[model samples]
Structures are given as C-alpha cells and as structure tokens.
Target: MEFEVQVRGRTARRWIMFGMIALGAMFLAIGLVLTGVTASFLSDAKRARGSVVALEWRDDDHGASGKTLEHDTPVAYPVVEFTSADGMPRKFRSSAGSNPPSYQKGDLVEVLYRADSPEDAQVNGFASLWLLPLIFGGVGLGLSGAGTAVAMVRRWRS
Candidate 1:
C-alpha cells in the first residue's frame, strides 16, 4: 500500500511537470507565430506621419468591482489623423492605452499601414510592434524553465 501511494505521487508530479512544460511550449509557439506576422506586416507596411487629434478614455477596472474603495483609473488611447499615400484622409484610435496618456493633442507620431487598408493603421514604435510577442515568449520561457528545473531536482533526488 505504501509503495502504491508513492508511485501515485510520483505519477502526479510527473503529470504536473509535463502539463506546465506543454502549456509553456504552446505559448512559445503562439509568440513565434505572432512575431512572424508582425515582421511580415512591417515589411509590407507603408509609413505616414500622423498627429493626435483626440484621446478616447475608458475605465480600466482591472476586473475589480466598482463597489470597492479602490477607484478605477481611466486609460487614454490616442486618436490619430493623417493622410494616406493615396492622398485620402484616415483616422484610427490606437490599440494601446496608458494611465497618464502617452500622447497629447497635436503630438506627431509615425504611422504604419498597408496602402490597400489605410484605416487599419498602427503607431510605428517598438512597444506597438514587439511588446506582445516579447511578453508571451518571456512567460513561456519562465514557465518551461521552472518545469525543467523541477524535473531535474526530482531526478537528482532519486
């Protein structure tokens, strides 16, 4: 009975380790795909200079209830306006937002977009392009490294 319990415990630990590693690997794969997509978009993207015309504000509750004493801060996303390569006017709200607001009204920023779809434009910056992939990849590496370390310790103990 004692031996059976010990074997079951080992099996459970192994399964948990495998689960973490697998999940991490999946995240890593997703990050890699996103990196490729971002690279491809940048390669085909056209550049234009845009100015912040306005700011769109929204409550960033962080999943907390309004009833709580803690107040939710508003996040500001910049609304940019610019002329496309085809001399057509375009406007788009940035996907990223900040608490204090990253951009002020009339602040000029570089924009990147495809000529065929100028409305779907993004601010040309490192944070706009590479932040997501870096985050996913970093998390994946941390999780996978932790799982591997656990496995190594277990093996060493045995």
Candidate 2:
C-alpha cells in the first residue's frame, strides 16, 4: 500500500537548516580561495612607483545603444605605466574596479608587482589587495556560525 506522509513544522525547519548549511559552506569555500590568493600576493611582491596614463571605462548597460547617457553606468579602470628594474617601460591595467573613478589621468600611484614579470601588477592599497578576502571571510564566518547554531538548536529541539 502507498503511504501519504504529512509534513510537520520540524521537518520544514530541518530543510531550512540544510539550506543554511549549504549556503554557508559555499561562502566558506570562496573565502578560503580568496584568502589563499591574498597570501600568495603578499609573499613576494616588490613595490614600484607608477603613473596613471588614462582612464578606461566600460558601460554596464549590456550593449543597450541609443539609451540615455544617464543609464550609462561606466566603471573606471586605471591604466598604469611603470619602468621595471630591467629599464623596460611596462604598462598594465590596475585590477581595482570602481565607479566614479578613484584616480585621475596623470595621478601617481604605488604599484606592487613581482620582479621577474611586471605585467601582473596591482595598485598598492588595501582596497586593491585585501578587500576581497576581508569581505568574503567576514561574511563566511558569520553565516557559518549562524548555520552551526541553527543546526544545534534544531538538534536540541528534536
């Protein structure tokens, strides 16, 4: 004989608990990856002075031409030029992305790069270097703690 089971509040809460655990796990994994990348960058980077050559902008409006200029949400990318230790002039785009343009053309900025290859250079700032890991790790820790607490509470209730 086929059996029909009635869903209870506890069963629904258990499903919710599982969902929270999954979300928390996903964030934790991303946070760990970002932390590792940040660690690698900090280990062997040399500081150099670079100048912003120009601002590159990309419209966020998904190729919607003929739209009003107000709809153009352009993000600014700073193109930096620096001379490596080998006396070769190298130009690279900063990895930092922002709206309203944090830098201007001809602005001098500090850049950090590996000595052997200057192409993988990044702007020398907390926002450029550690912001991603800090944000991901903070959110991951909070969500994971909340999920663990919820699982414990559900277990106690059962």
Candidate 3:
C-alpha cells in the first residue's frame, strides 16, 4: 500500500504561514538596524575603555496594553558610557533590567570600553548584544511569511 499526504484540509495552516512571513519580514528589518548600531558601537569601543554610567528611568508613556502605564518609568539601570572613535560620549543601557541595581546619579560602573571610541563598550559584563539575532529573526519571519502566503494561496485555489 502507498500513502500520500494531501494539502486538502481547510486548516489553520494559512494563519501559521501568514505569521511566519510576517515574522521573517520583522526580523529582517531588525537585523539591518542592529547591524548598523553594532558597527557604530564597535568602532567606538576600539578607541576607549567603556565608562560606567547611571541610567535613571525617564517618564512613562502609554503602553500598548495600558495595563500599567506607569510601568514605563526608567528605574535605574547600569549603563556603559564611552567616547566613540569620533570623540563622542555614548551611553548604552545595561542588560540588567530583570532586576536593575539600585542607581545613584553618579554610580560607579565597570566597563570595558574601546580606546578609539567610548560609545563601544561593555558594562558590568553586559554588552549591547542580541541585536543581530533579533534582526535575522525578523528577516527569517518575513521570508517565512511570504512563503506561507504563497502556500496558502495555492491551497485556497485548489
């Protein structure tokens, strides 16, 4: 006996395909932006050692869900500040949002900054990482979405 898989069922497959395509597009966009930002930071890091900086939560605006609009407050986070290769002081927020450290106006933070540029630096072992992955993820999603859309359209036609 021979078995065959037929794409006949009217199913959620269409939705799934659409989602993948959308995700791919989003990831692609994110990746591009991250690449640029990371490149700029890298140049700065090469020039000077990163300096520790304080990040005070700014004000809060309307959140998407609006469940806790006040949650947007910029509690304190450890940040790395350094001059870029172009002699510009750039500050990067720390990746310690899970449980931000108590911050003072001028708290001392340890950072490994580049000599040529201060903007490119890692603070408290936190670097501006994951930007690339995010971007790629978006691109992959977009492509997947496009493919899914095609598949779904074919299925619908049949």
* Candidate with best TM-score: 1
Off by over 4 Å in 3: 1-16, 43-45, 50-55, 58-62, 65-74, 79-98, 102-127, 131-158
Q: Candidate 3, 136: how far from true, in Å?
A: 6.5
The pairs that clash in candidate 2 are none
Order of candidates by TM-score, top first? 1, 2, 3
Please list the C-alpha lDDT of all candidates, in the order they appear. 0.89, 0.81, 0.58
Instruction: Please provide, for model 2 over 1-158, each residue's C-alpha lDDT reduced to its tens digit, 9 standing for 90 to 100.
Output: 12323356657777777777777778878888998987787788877889999999876455446564766687888999998777888899877767989899999998888897788999887778888877777777777788889988867987
Give candidate 1 regions above 4 Å deviation.
61-71
Pitting candidate 1 against candidate 3, the one with the higher TM-score is 1
lDDT of 1 by residue, 72-117 (tens): 7788989999999999999999988888988999999999999889
Worst 10-residue lDDT window for candidate 1 reads: 61-70
Higher lDDT: candidate 2 or 3? 2
The true-versus-predicted C-alpha distance at residue 80 of model 3, in Å, is 5.3
